[model samples]
Target: MGHGTENGVGRRAVLRGGLAASGALLVPATVAAPALALSGRPTATSGVQSGDVTATGGLVWVRSDRPARMVVETSATGSFRNARRWTGPLVGPDTDFTGVTRLHGLPPGEQIHYRVLLADPHDPRRTGEPVTGTFRTTPQSRRSGVRFVWSGDLAGQGWGINPDIGGYRIFDAMGALDPDFFLCSGDNIYADGPIAATQALPDGSAYRNVTTVEKSKVAETLAEFRGNFRYNLLDGNLRRFNAQVPSIIQWDDHEVRNNWYPGEVIAASDPRYTEKSVDVLATRARRAFSEYFPVSTLRPASDGRVNRVLRQGPLLDVFVLDMRTYRNANSPDDQAHDPQGILGREQLEWLKRELARSRAVWKVIAADMPIGLVVPDTTEGLPNIEAVAQGDPGAPLGRELQIAELLRFVKHRRITGTVWLTADVHHTSAQHYQPSRAAFTDFEPFWEFVSGPLNAGAFPASALDGTFGPERVFVKAPTASNVSPAEGYQFFGEVDIDGHSGDLTVRLREQDGSVLFTKVLRPGLVGQ
Candidate 1:
């Protein structure tokens, strides 16, 4: 998680007035449940729920306590008077006892209520306590806007459950924003370092926690990946949020192994990566990613791979990139001038084409790494490369490559209203990189913002320090000019686009939802 601008949920004005008025305008009544957590197991609630309804449809998720069939209901109320229903049996170890049913064929511009009914196998007369929640579909085109939560690096070292506290806070804050969806900017789990075996599925439970680093082995196996996911979802607050909002997710290093590059090993720099081995990891990661996330994967990668994009609506188009499965190791310090390719040639071509054809009011590239922070210069005056290497380098590499691409793409195509967003630096910062008369006078101005960890190991004091370092080198911007904070920590990225005036409002927030900073980027300012 890196800093783009110090900020919080400071866009309340925009949220209240103008095109941003889709602030839960349709969601009327709240459910009557006390939001209780089940005892003695991670399956706190009997079922699962997901929200942030869209124009077309939303999602409903649940997990059975035992082998069972469930009938999910979507209605305008608790009574099944006129509800939309989906019935299916929970199957396989693949879902880890959970089932996510995409509820389709709903009308737009209305608030919908939903719940799950565990059909009793024996009597068939008894139905388990119904779990209910509500969501508001996107308003008319002119009234719809886009908002999403972005953060990364949620692994912690010593504290048992302290790290997840920040993430819970983030969810509450995001609930206020009422975004159509939430995004996982990567590093969703810290299965790296020595604690590779600690991730697990607790006894008789649907969820688990990274109790000890000793057991959280880097997810090298399928079960390990599943357990890593279970550990994060086990948190009560996280579970509640996930049940309430359908999350659109993508993967970064920690999801597999930290700082992983294509066809290469990080430790020994060995080039012994096998297609079978790579596919094994990819398959496991995608399984866990798909099982736990609400995203719909329709256009699977052409090679029978897993890459896909979600077109939420005309307001936003999210292109979820698969940089890990294909990317080469970040360009080493020696090759900073000629960075090792981050986006493999094929993926790069696909991404450029996607951008070129997007017609949404806003195009959101859900990246899991910082795409603008100049790493080498940021670490220049620091302890040394050795010190910087102590943290993941994939983030800085991502930022570097994204910056290069954004500048070239916007200028070359005369594209307007493109925003770059990323997470993994563990702190918040925002930057508006525009072509300067003295710098690149012919290029268009673009903006990139970075958000820090939602929950993770405590960042070093040096990260917050204000000294010339390799990490600080990329702070050059429309505001900071040439100054970069030597260090900072714990933040997330948020952008509010006004459908009324075509203006984009961005913010970087701390754990408590305090706005550390803010910036406004106008579509008219591009190429200025």
Candidate 2:
């Protein structure tokens, strides 16, 4: 049942030593190269990644340069000797040679070592080199602490994979923290920004990107959108990080275009997009996103909804929302009705029900867009196309009406330890909403933390809507265009929840892993 020889070692000992059972058999530098060289087979270009982990199972993802068969081997021990083999779907041109395999029937709260093997499409006997990855399942007991990281906006605003500086080095910084998993808040890729081989910096120096023909133009077709995902895998750091940290990914506007609504028509003046209809382009983008990431819940449903709940043992419950799919057109004059809001009636009801039923200590709303931020689109002129807000700082209007209702429900239900984590504004900030300071103060006090632009242009802060009485506790943003990671403004957020005390610590970190701000919250401490 196992492919490799077994080593006599316990899983706990292996994890405590920070080494896998397979580590003893392979050299770190030559693992991928020597194995493929000996077999004369095409190796995986994007390495291996594991994600969407539960107590019993998880998903593993890989991308090959050519058509191949996806095979995965998992073991309780690191040596992977006597590991259970799971044959996955075909990795073919239909999915841009990327595929994911689900691993099931594993023990909870234990380290699972896995290797990804790609077999020849025609000859199953011939296999490529194996890429190794490890992930720990969610703890079954309520006594174990949980930690995870989150961020958004990858490769945006003309920022691309730069070989000279090591592409997206911030991922490396995040990976070093060794969290349980990574939650990609949104904007996994920038389909609207074209990447060039060389980008001139504001300092008059040239910043180089490892560009491809598909990335040179704005993504339109399905192939182009898939290429955007493949392009980010070119970086060795990202590939290594993906292998180590399993991801829970969600999408935002840049995954298709900038602040695009569902049924909007592309303006002819924008030369980059030739697809007149934005929905058509979003369909292509959504398919590519599903194929590339290991999130199993991203499957296309009949109603076109992608909202789901991710429960990590008894510690945390993450409700991933689909903000883009059912949203109305961005307009200030829109009515304050539930059907015409950001989260439609159906989704809002589901969120409330899930929050009320959740037994986890912390209830996290993984919103792609911020609540109070004033995001306006003036391309069509006049009162401005507002995505989530009507820009009225005083009262709830347009999309804010739905959000206000949700907040009120939380207060009525007396839900404690509920926090919001979002990334879309391409900056990092900590906001505290107090009933006393807000215009409409029916809900209990809560916190919202924003961090983003994994590698993108940084912008100024957005004005907050006063409907929730949000106060800016902390803020950090770059004053320049297309800021690089070396500038040290790029940010990510980490949440660590202690099982014993039920205390939650939220830390906002810079690109270099330095903490920008830290907040600690205890259970039943709402409005404190």
Candidate 3:
């Protein structure tokens, strides 16, 4: 019980100065700090994260540059020995000074070692520096084998955070693939893209960015969408890949604009918003995306629903899908009998009773769009339909009739290790679907893959809606369209799941930790 010696500073020298002020040795910025963190003792310099991890529990984000007093403690080592605390809250700017803090029972596949101090909300022992990190829970033994990594668009189009190409360094190649959870299958943030301090490439060089002023515009209020999630936590390799990865987040439509739905109305040929009601900018981008990620279905009197089901043990469960908040309204989607399509209708019957009560032998759906591709939402050029295939090849119309009734209820409830995984159309592919290349052949042949735009802007590969008869086998986009990330199509995807051969293997990486495609899948399969 001794995190002792605060002001005298020596509890392993405040754990080696909070593990060198939150590891990955700081070297970048896309910050939005209105200054003010000069020692009234409550800092948290935007780092120290952890999220929906499970098999006991997790969730430990942080923010505090001003109205502090978060606590978080946990410890299974890292000299934080005998740790175990929680005590958070009072983060200010009404949560733009974030703060998540959940952590529970813990100890189900060990290795936690957390930290995060902040104090001084009127002197909580006047704390200040302390920021460590670690994660690795989720393993109620199934012979214990599982790895994770998934990605999504980030800093899109006019890509932000560049620090001469190290900010968001593909999260240091996805935190050196030490995966166990990272499924951020959605444009984590791009709030209608607008980051410019220079991005002029057409082979004429220049790409700078590390800009601010709430990303130089286009994220309608709520403090510019909480400064677009504090500008990707001023990327120190995304705060050391969010202090060693644990995320499982989901959210699409540039987190609030590009292709937004639900009573949509910001179209004056796009005026970068005067809050032109896309439901008041998606209720201020879902309250700054529920105060910046740490989703367990986003609490705080819940209703920030990102459609849950992470589950990760008995060999995986994922299912994330909130395909842009219960869709329906970007249409050219030929409706036949739309059931509020695009996963609306109680999230498509709670993803069909949680994929028939998954016992987890894979299941992974996690899609934030990408069901037989298509995706076109042209906006005043009119022919809409953003996601869930509406370039229809017959049968299943609009939002492909809720993915053709959840792939005909997982091929009539035989739900055998279903696979899907996604990342909006920004390149990287692999499809398989198959009902023998037909239209609506009641699901069963599966495998979706797709990677990402982790460092954003890399399109050119989306057009495959033969209504559930996909088959692209593999593709690597970027011949044209948005391309930049220094012109090298960025991406991420990894899955591994074998604990005694339940084989799930999906590696489709790139952005330097190359491994373009690798499929495997044979865990109670229905399609080889």
Candidate 4:
């Protein structure tokens, strides 16, 4: 997969055919070859990705199999005539051989081409054939229009990359739309869900997974967690998608363990794990998460928090929330005086302040879990609640109190053009919250869109808690639980904000790129 193109265009340039193209987001290269044994050229098999992109800058990532110097070069076009060079880190064992470089001074709304080279530390001349990528910066003008795709829950419930089905075909479908970016709404990796080589499908076919050592079991150690991130790069479709789309990533429960929170210990009865402390595992997982994704705020030297506002020009400002990191333990969720609920106190305040300060046409809140979805905890059984809602319909209780407080604040501030997008439930649905129909009538009406499972098991839509009076306008879910990808029901959502008219359209699409549902909202409206 090294420099398959002659004139210096990326080998993946043929991805115009999208899913049909044989190009990979990452193709396995021989990264561990002896340094001085042969030609001594360093290799980067993990491909390349860019994320946390803004109008002026972005971050690029790559992994080397051996000790090598990371070097990045960028160009306005594919031609490397007047490229700018940036010397990156010396990627080695300390960070698991992965490195990220920040790219600055990029022009807004224009496609910037780049290439990554892994060079021998001693000699710059000894370098691997470059891996190339391209992405457009966020537009500075409101009239430029903006569009992005979102989904979550990858390789969960025992599903992994299936080479028989083109290895994450959903990415190819999404990449075809040419979204400005991708909002990966958490559950980016399933540290607790181990994948097998092959399994029989109910439809008389077999699900053949592209297996890797890291994806074989629950990740506990730091290396295993890093492997969990690298495991997804084995899929050519996903690798291609990463090369094309810059992602705004956040993590949910699956990245560390199923339904995990701080200070929680795995029950001893679950013998699959020896590491009982979820905190220890989470510390390791968080480092790996920071290393893997290119979040501007979560860089290695930074404070490493997921809650930040990404200003996408004048049209959109995405408030990425980390509901997993800072939260009270999952329980019956009925505490009447709980302020440190799902979002904790600090992140909740930050979100509220950011929402009030956003001057963009739309303020899209990206929540890892749905607000009103009744996501119950199956671990250790009983009445433990996993997400925001706790099934009580009467008054705001437990984590619902935090959400109610935020909604009330929004109402009092007269904040308009707000919408919520999430995807932890593995189904596609839309809800319109209205005060007139509500038990809690303090907040103004808004829309929440849920879509996902991207390449994982599909479950029935979770029961909606009536705390915010969210009416399910549309829902598409499987009747059975944990439906395999072979049986269909995989989904992703698209948001297209028209520049001239300022009408935001949301489309829920399936794995095959079929639009399942659509909702349109105006910019200056109190409600849709």
Score every model by TM-score.
0.71, 0.90, 0.37, 0.94
Best-to-worst TM-score order: 4, 2, 1, 3
Which number leads on TM-score? 4
lDDT for 198 in candidate 3 is 81
* Candidate 1 lDDT by residue in tens digits, 1-528: 212111223221111111122222121211122113222211213236563245768666666554345667877654558877788554334465566667778877556667777654443445666665555566556455556677766653311232312323455666565655677777676544323322332243221122432223445666666666655554555655554555666667666554544553333332322223444565676676666555555212324333455665666677776656665544333233323355566776777888888876667776665443433322112221111122333322332444355447756886656776776655566655444411223445555577766655433222321111122313211222111111124466677777777566877776657777777766656542
Residues 349-374, model 4: lDDT tens digits: 99989999989999999999999889
For residues 1-528, write the lDDT of model 2, one tens digit per residue: 000000124322122111122212211111222223344665677788888899899999988766778999998777788899999877766777788888889999888888889988678898887888888899998787888999998888777776566568888788778788999988898888777767777778876766766787889999888878877776767777787778888888878887778899987787777788999999999999888888777643334456788889887999999888788877663565646577777889999999999988899999998887776666555456445655566767778788888999999998887999998887899999998988778999999999986877777777787878889899998665446654556889999999899899999998889998999998888785
In model 4, the Cα lDDT at residue 140 comes to: 94
Which is better, 1 or 4, measured by lDDT? 4
The lDDT ranking, best first, is 4, 2, 3, 1
- Whole-model alpha-carbon lDDT for candidate 2: 0.78
lDDT values of the candidates? 0.51, 0.78, 0.78, 0.85
lDDT of 2 at 381: 53
Give per-residue CA lDDT, model 3, range 1-528, as digits (tens). Answer: 000000222111112221222322223433334435454676776787788889888888888777777998888777776888889787876676788988889989877878888887666888887888788888898787888888888888777766666667787676676777788887788887778778788978888876767777788888888887887787677787787777888888887788878898876766666768888888888888888888867777766688888787898888888877777777788878888887788988988999899888888888888888887777546777777677758888777887777888888888888888888787888888889896778777888888888887887787787877888989999777887788788888888888999898888888777898898888875778
As for candidate 2, its clashing pairs are 21-78, 21-79, 22-78, 438-469
Candidate 2, residue 131: the lDDT equals 86
Candidate 3: global Cα-lDDT? 0.78
